[model samples]
Target: MTHEEKKKEESHGRPEIPAWMRAVAEVISAPGYERWARQVAATGGCSAPVRLVGESQVIDAGTGEVLHIYRTADEPTGHLLVACGNRRGAVCPACSHIYQRDVFHLIRSGLSGGKGVPEAVREHPRVFATLTAPSFGAVHTQRERNGKTLVCRPRRGGGVCGHGVPERCGARHDGADIRVGQPICPDCYDYAGAVLWQAHAGRLWHRFTLELRRQLARRAGMSRRRFDALVRVSFAKVAEYQRRGLVHFHAVIRLDGPGGHDDPPPGWATAQLLADAVPEAAGLVQVLSPDPGNGQRVLAWGDQIDVRAIVVRGDGGGLSDEAVAGYIAKYASKGAESSGTIDRRLSCGRCKGVGTVTMARGPAVCKRCGGVGTAGGLDLDRLPVTEHARRMIRTCWDLGGRPELEELRLRPWAHMLGFRGHFATKSRRYSVTLSTLRQDRAEHKTAESRQRNGLPGPESTEVLAHWRFAGQGYTEAQEILAGHISQRAITARRIEEQRREGA
Candidate 1:
């Protein structure tokens, strides 16, 4: 039958299938189905794969001979697919999973000494340190002691804040309780102070590092210059968004020789000494935020600080290299989403992010967003964000307007709750870099492909490439298929792991 006749026939006395299912059926029956599947599998089922139309030539440099040529037109699908390497898990889980693995190796290689690092570096003094943001207000929290849960902020006598809200919470809270990070009295919370602290968090960390070095020098009874010549501090830190919509740093701090991890640390450098210096430095280090109409405020680390020695094994009440690496890597893929904020940027629905719109009266500041260009504008109560997060975002918007604070760009990062620093960072000599790891993987993949295709080696050949962006992401049907492929890949890896363990 003709195409039109076949469609008419199928429509007779039959329930219509969903559009997505029909599209999937079309994909499965297509001639290029196998090739598309292979491409998707290669990307590890990336949710938003970038499509490229390109041609590449591998030529003999000495003889000017073309050994191999690749063109997207020759492929079954008219495009080459590449993974969107977004690190945020909420944005791209498959890519983020790969990124997390890379981060794990990057951290572990420094701690345990592998991937070009000397094993002797393991003897260097190192500690796992947590630096927290100072509290802006009392919030519902969960505490535990001796493996038993404790009530949050109990008070001897009932008291109320200036806003007439209770100043204490006596009830025990679960880990997943929605109110765990909420302020006991939103009206009494120092929203401006919190936002300013978030903005200056990076600066506070820089000052803390400097103070840590100074403290270490003082402990060893040496001048700052003399200490710098003898010892080098290295660290790998990840910023985690707490339930209170603020970020705290989890860092692995190590003391190495002035030459870096390759050199032996000074005799006086020890894990206990490094741990002792951490809290002292954190306590003393502070940063002053830009004045935003209100009075300037001092930003400092919170009172609670944790510093623990890192051990090769966890047998001695210390963290192991594997556990520490894994712990930091887990947070590398997260962001402010944990605090009930949207991952994507929000623009004013009324003004469409242009700050002002033509109205019946005249062009005026957007009443919805207070001309700040964010959704829900001045009326944060209507936004989906938590009350605490809403207040933080509102503070960010308000402070972002002041000319003095313009350099901080608080409005652009308001989604991040005014924090605009890289979530994962490391000192220069901490370990192998993420870029190096990625390059090595790419080179290995290229070599494998050349070997499989029986092509000449890179040393004997030169490569020239041309590519242009075609598109990104997937249709509903493609997304469904990619999800299935991702699940299968995960299952296969799990099975292989189990088999290896059994063996």
Candidate 2:
């Protein structure tokens, strides 16, 4: 149909769908729309479902009979649709929701024991640990004591010192304040320290874990090797961005038998021992590196290291397992989506080397080909970022030039403030993995499809298919329909969450 005709028809009785969406809307308005809709709906409305061209046939292993056959050519889109699977909600909400559910199950399984984890793991000691970035300078914080909002950075007689910035602001800052994480005096803030510290945060966690094992062994008056043979430590952690743009870790740490979670921990091993070792490990653990400008510096964790026991069922002891699992899972899908933290690297370094710099002139040099390693873009310079973050990025860029710090690759990751680590990680024996869970779910889905269609299961035959990466993303019309589907899926997920909470 013509664009104008479709518009007129939409106006006559049906709700007006966008011109780009008319093609998909017409399909929905066509006969046998439910089956077509369900095909797209199966992906939960992925914004960019992969388009695959393939065919498959289920053959009976014994009789060599073709029980079922399917091909992408017969699909509504003329290709198969699969979730893009971007964990970042900002990038793809539908995929992120799916990821979150998987992480939730993974974490919950480890905490309370399920999905291949033994129930004995529940009896083993575990702690919810939070590792934070050290203070660069005083920033606006919401502090409350006994339900009373205290003055932020209260200074006597409106005292103003070095840098001429306000020494105190008595106004109890709320969440909406734009200056919350901004350093009180950007000049005084250790921007370089913050950036370098971020680069080492992951290593710092590594050191902490290593030291923890040593500490536990020392407490037991045994050698490290002997400790390793006696008990095992397992943990699952995810990085979360603070308002200040630095990354902190939220981890669920558990103790297990040498055999793994399925086995009980040694009698001497306890949750309290793990908790006690955490503070000492954090205090002693330090990443030693030559400062970008100075000689040597010791990077340690923030003072506010939190280690709380995770109570599986009732909250008579500490926080519940459900809350801890849900909290970690919430951030798992976030994938470092936050303000002032650039999600990707800047294009400037694509230049051959740092020897020569291409300066951007009148019109912005599109970072495509002509502008490779170009300089003088005020795009980031003009943004209203906190001076703390601004300097951190600048430090990353400056440090990138130093040969001594070449391994850090500060310039390439200046956008991330010099952090180059996975957003989510777990040690072996933490629980079932995302890949395993997805595989199980897919197998179950295949079984369900076979039963629904009264077709023999894959067990009865050898199924083979040829597939190729046709493309990714949807046409404009498909995107609109996908958006509709994704939104419904999100709503359904929320309803499920609410129901679980209510139950």
Candidate 3:
């Protein structure tokens, strides 16, 4: 067509069918789906919903044989409706808002004793602690307190690294500084060591916990194996990425009796005792491996260990059980990609240059400006170095594989490099479990649905459903609608929370 005609056609384009059309089609094709479709259509618009097509056998109560066959226009079509559980704020806000609310409830339950947890747990010796990775090199940092800016890292000048760069930062940086993650001198940073350390951080934490238990047992004047019979330790932890792209950890540790929820701890169990044990355990713990290239690599916790006794007032005091639990739940849904790493494997052999990193075959190189010898490069023979810089190097091989160090592998989390532990894990005695919390929420949702639908009873005489994974994303129209829904949900929740607090 001519350019003028094409312009007109583009300007007056036909309205595209809503993506929820599939769901509508499924509903129309399923047995008794016509009624449900009419109900759904009356609600105006739902960007996307599950579409199922199937047959149902309706049998008489007194007879074993089927009394009737109910089918939609398509004999085999059956459809079921299920909520899409998307939690990203940028994507489906409706699902994300629901997810966030569930998380809040889950966390609050763990803190204040609901969802099967004993209320007495509020008195348990619990502390919210943060463990950070050691600095690979100095970089830009944001500093602010009481509305005033401060020097990012104000160390004494004149100190120099092995590479002769100044070891201190003097610049006053704002919160929006883009150079925060960049090393002051890339060569001076122990990139290999940092990545390798990250890869084995989960293992290190495991060892720390085990050692902490041992130390606690010794302190209590009991044998290591027999400690569980007297007292049990429970903890929930989440990993956070620092400005330098290294993973650190935030955790809430609690002490309880041997029988978990059924019993209280002995009088000897106190927050002070747990606090003391943390640093000692951290210091004594070590992960050893015989290196083929080097003689051996002895990995130990960094010197910057912090152990605090969390209280109910002050800076550390304000760290309530609810707040700690909420913080952990928020981080659980995140992945490494949230911190700016590529979620998929970098492509081989495609190098552009300097500013742009491209994933392609050959060696991983910057797509914008080709730069090699970094974590994104194709030097597989060297090591998988990038964000964790130190740990992914060849020198750290067998770091988490020693026979004496089986507890550190975190084998369940192999996908997250060697940091194979749950984003949040709790010992049985802590308070409540994630499973119980989820079930409680589910039951609440079911009851709410029943109430809204004005069901005759809790039980349903006939329930039919079918569902499939259409895809896990939203179209432009759905995206807009989801945003509005999410905003409303958030506002409503905030108001509710405020009302509850006021009451």
Clashes of each: 1, 2, 40
Order of all candidates by TM-score, from best down to worst? 1, 2, 3
lDDT of 2 by residue, 1-503 (tens): 99999888778977656775568767678765666567667877687788789998888899887878899888656777788888888778888888898988898889888899987788889999998989988877777899888887888788775978888878787767767777788888888788889888889999999999999899888999999999999999999988777889999999898888888888889989999988888888999877956998899999889999888676477988889998999998764336455554563544522434456654454454354342344354544555666777777777777888878877767777788888888898889999999999899888898889798766567987788889988767666776777788778867988899699
Q: Is candidate 1 or candidate 3 better by TM-score?
A: 1
* C-alpha TM-scores of all predictions: 0.90, 0.84, 0.68
Q: How accurate locally is residue 382 in candidate 2, as Cα lDDT from 0 to 100? A: 49
Model 1 per-residue lDDT tens digits across residues 211-299: 99999999989999999999999999999999999999999999999889899897899998899999999999878776656567678
TM-score of model number 1: 0.90
lDDT of each: 0.87, 0.80, 0.57
RMSD of each: 4.4, 5.5, 8.9
Off by over 4 Å in 1: 1-14, 347-383, 493-503
The better-scoring model by TM-score among 1 and 2 is 1
lDDT of 3 at 409: 40
Where model 3 places Cα greater than 4 Å from the true spot, the runs are 1-107, 143-148, 153-168, 289-296, 312-318, 343-420, 448-465, 493-503
Q: Give the clashing pairs for model 1.
A: 369-377
lDDT at residue 334 of model 2 (Cα atoms): 69
